[model samples]
Target: MDLERPVQIVWQGPFTLAAAIASSTAPSKGVYQIYGQHIVFGPNSLLYVGMTDGQTFGARLAQHRDRWLVHEDDVTIRLGVVADLDSSARLADIEALTIWWHSPPYNSKNIWTYGGGPLRIQNLGARGRLHPEYSSHWKPARTPPDGEHP
Candidate 1:
């Protein structure tokens, strides 16, 4: 399950799609990390983790421009090119692993009481095995209103 690979610094420091165009590190496909100010777990200060297969990292970043964190001026972006060909599944797996590990607020599909705080899961199965307490925490993700996408 290790997707360890070298990642280039595609874009950083209050990222915007317009910035990606000026930077040479922009990658066409791979994983991306969105960092927020507060540290949630360990030394990793991540707000979201995402993967791009058929789209450019710039395009993907643009899609998230209106997210909650976008309102923050300190948010940054880092992108890595998918080194392996035909590794879309692996990239998806890595995305899940990252979200589970960091539990970023925006990734929360379902909120559960865990570790004396709320736990968010973008993909429950990706969480793999869990402690017995989590069984009681299963909750569905909130649906957006009337054709809106959250």
Candidate 2:
């Protein structure tokens, strides 16, 4: 099954949304390296470094969000494809090095998403990932509780 669920990156005019999805498909299973970071746009305009392969790359970004819904929040999870061995000293390196590189943009936070660390769903309805904890803490004032509104 394809692990990297395709997503669109809504950027400036130079980069069209269609272009991002065409390239963001998940890599094969053998093993891929990456640097992923979470971004929440609200006039702040910042970015993070992230990576993934046939595993968590696609959905994890969606995990680090709020409104549990993709179309609702400003945070967009993105993973930077990092090629080369010695990328990480160990498996833990995945989270360590990547988050380290994008620490400032990540607000000095550590990324919990890693090679099948958790939250792996092999089916559609992927948007169910929209859980309160997965959402960004900084959201609209009266968005209503999880089930109450959405």
Candidate 3:
């Protein structure tokens, strides 16, 4: 059986509090990722993956403007629209799969249970972090020159 892959990032960029609030393209319903160059999870950077159904991306992103930023000046947002996952259940599945694959610092790595049972597991690491369709377009995180701190 073939395993699913990581969600694709359709759009991504560094944003400030004011920029995030003003961006109109982020007002869609989908999954989002927040990456920070801080020590939230550990020394190897941090990525926070989340999803939104009823709430628009713009609104949800705006909410994070307050406390989500571990590094005020070093934060980037990656937005991925799960076209296949038009339902809430599918959205949650994608979110869970992403968390499992990347094991981002901000996400829980514990066994996820639901409806009095364990959540179904799948192999999502086959295609790397971003979904296969968008994986080719994936750009490694920008790093400092050499001696410069990230």
User: How many pairs in model 1 have backbone atoms within 3 A of each other, for residues 3 or more apart or on separate chains, i.e. clashes?
Assistant: 0
Q: CA lDDT of each candidate?
A: 0.48, 0.30, 0.53
> Per-residue lDDT for 74-128 in model 2, tens only?
3333323323223233323433333332333443344332232322112122111
Q: Each candidate's TM vs. the true structure? A: 0.52, 0.32, 0.59
Tens digits of per-residue lDDT for model 1, 4-29: 32211222344543574345556656
Top model by lDDT, which number? 3
* Ranked by TM-score, top first: 3, 1, 2
TM-score of 3: 0.59
Candidate 3 displacement at residue 92 in angstroms: 0.7
State the displacement of the C-alpha of residue 74, model 2, in Å, after optimal TM-score superposition: 3.1
Best by TM-score: 3
